[model samples]
Target: MGRSKDVLIYIDRRNCDFFQNISDKFQVIFGLNNFWLAKFFIKTKYILFVLVNIISFYNNNENGLVNAVVAIFFATVYLVKFCQKCEIMEKMYEKGYNLFNENLILCRLNRGLFFVLLVLFCGMGSALICLNGLTFFVCTHMLLAFCIVLIICAEYFYACTPRPKGKSKVKLLFQKIQKKIEKIISPEPVPDSC
Candidate 1:
């Protein structure tokens, strides 16, 4: 709710040289609580996903490669979740800069303990890899793929909430349990993350 003085701002790292020139060094007011860590974590997820896709595809790594095979689907799913219902707002600060075209998209989200869950899952993956005689640094792709699988599963559960007409029993279950799970994760009502 406050225009934070110190905050973590993130954008996906683009490999192309052109994006470096156009990247805005502006801090938009963050609409949530102290979310530097959360924002950084979300950025990390995208980095991991992209790295995994590159490494798996480039190295021809197909051993236990279901995650790689369906990566495009997962990427699409993640994009839909993040970019759904975004509204581009006309600029109020573009009076001087003619060379730089800039606009903001208002995208709302129910973060709903997503950052917390992601850390836990990623940690679990790290633990699994460590136990199997592998270093986390050595197997970033597998670890992230594992974490992303859990993220997609969580997304599925969220999607099943009884928001639509003619709700199924599963949706009803989600509706009833959603509040309880949120409460368990946080005492105060959690706000949007994205």
Candidate 2:
């Protein structure tokens, strides 16, 4: 498994770099305030899930308490992992979450959309299951399955898209040219004059 992961990481290094760039931008825009709010949203979402489960506990006939507990457990673990990943991004940049004012609004908007989806899906699935019979149950199950597949696809696309080789080579050459120009224009550092 570890070997496979390493190979996957190697294959997707470019996408990983792009993802890191987006994460850096998100940290700048959302800063600590929106990030913390996102955390709160996650917690509240979980609480809402638990409350729904409790309300429907007596009515559950299929997966029952077992499924509810498992779902909540997985969701909580994912939330913690998400926060840790965000923290690592901040550490990588040597800055707090609030580096770019322009990004803050975007970050908030992105997270808000995510929270809305999470609640809509989880809450609706839980409620629908208790209110009806086989049709509702199957529909909720399919919807949840679709949601999981969508998330998997999004992750893969973000982590595995490769740049065309010729385009990448040209981009590198232009970057080198830009660096050379900067070196020529900048004042030289004087040794032992710090």
Candidate 3:
């Protein structure tokens, strides 16, 4: 399985093209936020899973009630996370979720993620409040989660920065370069015979 040749190809050409067709149809959305949305959910879930394991393993010396509460809280968190991951991945590929056709979809997604940031803020507050139960590993994992989410959120928001009206200088420069390249690449047209 480590080698490319050792892997089996389960998807036939037909099924593969069908999905590729969806990708081509929503190329714009996929090119933009869908991928970042998927990344955020998957990364956040990874951290949540780690935190859950750490809480269960390291809290043996602590009060059982506190341990259970922390474990349950993390469990609920990851459960929601898994669902969110599935939802975003599902919508990302589905033709029904075209961002261009339904312009507000992206707007709604932004709003939803902003709400997720708020929820994470609340979790950070709770984690800080429960510093009594903190272990080096536990605190590190939670802080890692906070930092990872913060950085991804920053990048994702930065990606959504609004452009000013009309073609920007960078775009115009690219178009000029493209036109010159095309001119050089094309053969001269032959004179039409009467």
Candidate 4:
């Protein structure tokens, strides 16, 4: 029993580390705030799957334009929500706020979006597989399946992981950028006439 407990603890620590590392990388790459980065990593697979489904459906369907528009709308909503989340995270970070109590609310929003994306992808995949059968669509379907599994694994790792504290490399880089922007926007002090 003790050994098992130790193993679980070790696993949790490793998961947390993994989360932190990925979150940092994502922040650097996407300029997402830490809080949003956490959510993004958790939802990465679903987002990608939804995108692929949208593109595939748009390409293969008769009502291609309509499908493409709707898919684009959903993608746009996701991006907008992500931007809003990043703004909220930035405010919270500046306030030194901890989200421990609000984790459920944040998670529910994240999970709900993920669920919607999953259902959409599944429906699209099923339609393609059924209508098209074991044809060229099968290759795309297989790729989608692989991506879903990969996303599931990623979600697991993120769930097991804890949010990282302290400034990440990305945060530091952004700080520098912000400082430069501030310098540009703020007027330089006039040299003393005397």
Candidate 5:
């Protein structure tokens, strides 16, 4: 609610270059909090899916290649998650920029938690194989493929779905800031006398 003068911004190193640019532009328009990360995921997932599949296909091997495939998938997911986070944060600052707002902030935090879960699962699956040998390898690949599906679904939903709440966050924030700036510049209203 209150204007924040100092805030530390965090960026994930795994973010794609193009995504970074888009997020920056979005922030300029909306603010950081208003940025929607899932929408970006929906936008980029297909391209990412194709690239990941190509990499996995080439890297696919019969001699315990599943581990490598899973590793690559895990890494890619990490990158996507980071890019999404950056975009959402930027949007928040631009459109949903409320340092004192609780609901919107919690939503972003929920997103961060989901990313953490994805990473944990990736880590767990990978570590299980490294520690337990071939026993868990096949299972890990199954999980990796499942994660890929989830990514695709997310992308599709973001592209097609009408999320009124999300839309409002961006729209209302923009209106709020615009009115505030106008008020600041022109505080007094003129009265007409007949």
Candidate 6:
């Protein structure tokens, strides 16, 4: 009984550490310094749109691909504008200005966009749940929804938690992978001959 309790505690601790590591990596990837957040949003939305269109096509719905392309284009434009506004706000904050008063309109617009995204995600999740009877739909759609929720939760945790000291494990792993790729891609020089 004692051994089982110890094993359970170890597992719980490991899970917490894993979550913290994920949260840290999420923060670094989506840090507010540049366009990472914008890129993330754009990519995620585009992928989701594509997935939805694929599902529609499988269901014999015409015009799904065209609609997906149109939606992605508009979403990309909106996300770019939103990212610009966020950058402006960050600049204002850095300059010691009151963000709320200085960027009232932009803030409102951001809030509106956020709510729209929230509603869209919720609707998609509901649609997936409704189609849960289908094996393929349940596997793909629900997995996508789970990933989206996990990302959101990670971001939220990152915002609430203080930055951990030392380099992130994810960053180190990426750096190692990058170095290996570079070594593979850059061929060694041949000896001088003739």
Q: Local distance difference test, per candidate?
A: 0.41, 0.50, 0.48, 0.57, 0.48, 0.52
Higher-lDDT candidate of 4 and 6:
4
Clashes of 3: 0
> Over the stretch 51-101, how does candidate 3's per-residue lDDT look in tens digits?
655655565555745765676576567546645644554455353443432
Comparison by lDDT, 2 against 6, better one: 6
> lDDT by residue for model 1 over 1-194, one digit each (tens)?
23331221122112111222222111112211112222333445666676766676766656536666587567657655443311111121223332212211111022224444556666766677777765544476355655554443333222221111234455567778998888888877578895
For candidate 1, give the lDDT.
0.41
Total backbone collisions, model 6: 0
Model 6 lDDT per residue over 150-177, tens place: 4443232222232424565567788999
- Model 3, CA-based lDDT: 0.48
lDDT tens digits by residue: candidate 5, 1-194:
13231221132122222344554455555544223544455436545544545555555556335655675566667656756654555455447454323433343444445455667666766777777555444464545555554553343222221112343357788889999999899857677873
Return the lDDT, model 4, position 81: 70
Instruction: Name the weakest run of 10 consecutive residues (lDDT summed) in model 4.
Output: 153-162
Taking all chains together, the TM-score of candidate 1 against the true structure is 0.33
Q: Give the TM-score of candidate 6.
A: 0.41
Winner of 1 and 6 under TM-score: 6
- Number of the top candidate by TM-score? 4
TM-score of each: 0.33, 0.36, 0.32, 0.45, 0.28, 0.41
List the candidate 1 regions with Cα displacement exceeding 4 Å. Answer: 1-47, 56-60, 63-66, 88-110, 129-132, 136-194
lDDT of model 1, residue 107? 16
Cα-based lDDT at residue 141, candidate 4: 59
Query: What is the per-residue lDDT of model 2 for residues 1-194, given as tens digits with 9 covering 90 to 100?
Result: 99975765464454435555554444444433223433444555556555555544546857677877887688779767756644554353344333443333234334335445656766666676777775545455445544443443234222221221233344567789999999999998889966
Off by over 4 Å in 6: 1-42, 54-61, 100-194
- Model 6 is weakest, by summed lDDT over 10 consecutive residues, at 153-162
What ranking emerges by lDDT with the best candidate at the front?
A: 4, 6, 2, 3, 5, 1
